[model samples]
Target: MDERLETLAQRTGQWLRTHGWRLATAESCTGGWIAETVTAIAGSSDWFDCGWVTYSNAAKARQLDVPATLIDAQGAVSEAVVAAMVRGALARSDAQVALAVSGIAGPTGGSPGKPVGTVCFAWGGPGAAVRTQTCRFAGDREQVRRQSVIHALEGLLQADTTAKSVP
Candidate 1:
């Protein structure tokens, strides 16, 4: 794991512990990389809830309830799909925070618009707080996946922090 990712995970774990929140994940291109990184810490079991690797579109629909029609219309690596993934993970788990990712992290899956390294991320919680982003990173397969995981952690940290500041 990158040092930055480790730091972000540490911060996220600390914040979740402070705020009495747990986290879940729904992953596609990065596999379970985000969950793996989160669980790397010794006591992460307290804050880390669960993770689902829904790589295939069918799996996304079956596991995370991502709509088949949405995947068919917008493909798997889109904001709508990732948002649905996050919402589904949040709904299924007892977690108060959720991160979801879908992407084309490869040399082959490049189309004109949605090229490789195009990753979509979504973070949501119990309240009306949901955020999403689309990042076009520059790297190989592993590099892109790693970057995606780091960004997901960063987003979680940001969300957790903002949620805390809300009076």
Candidate 2:
């Protein structure tokens, strides 16, 4: 993991511990990198729940409860799937805060509309205060995944202020 990523994860862990909150992650294109970065911190188990690496479409549907219809309509990398992933992660875990990411970080997955490096993110918790966004990053597969991990941690740090539904 990158040093900056480690630092961000440390800060996020501290935030979770300070607020008595635990976090769960639902990941796709970045695999388990987001979970790996957070668990790298010592004592992360205090604020970190298990992570789900739902890389396959079936996994997203079966593991995250992302509707197969949604995946069929918008594919896996859309805002809808990512939002469902967040809800599923929070619902399935003891976590009060959660993040979800799905994207095309590839050398070959690019299309005219949804090109490579296009990542969708969702952050939320118990209620209806979810925030979702799509980011088009610049880089190769490794770099894009790295950026997604960094950005996900950055978002987690702000959950206290940004998520009205999270406690």
lDDT for model 2 comes to 0.87
Compose the digit string of candidate 1's lDDT tens values, residues 92-162. 99999998999999978989999899998888876755677789999899899999998888887664442
Q: Write one digit per residue (lDDT tens) for candidate 2, span 103-164.
A: 99998798999999999888885554777778899989999999999888888666435333
Q: Candidate 1 at residue 1, lDDT?
A: 70
TM-scores for all candidates: the values are 0.92, 0.92
Kindly give the stretch of ten consecutive residues in candidate 2 with the minimal lDDT sum: 158-167
Candidate lDDT scores, in order, read 0.87, 0.87
- In model 1, residue pairs whose N, Cα or C atoms come closer than 3 Å (at least 3 residues apart or on different chains), thus clashing, are none
Span of ten consecutive residues with least summed lDDT in model 1 = 158-167
Candidate 1 residue-pair clash tally: 0
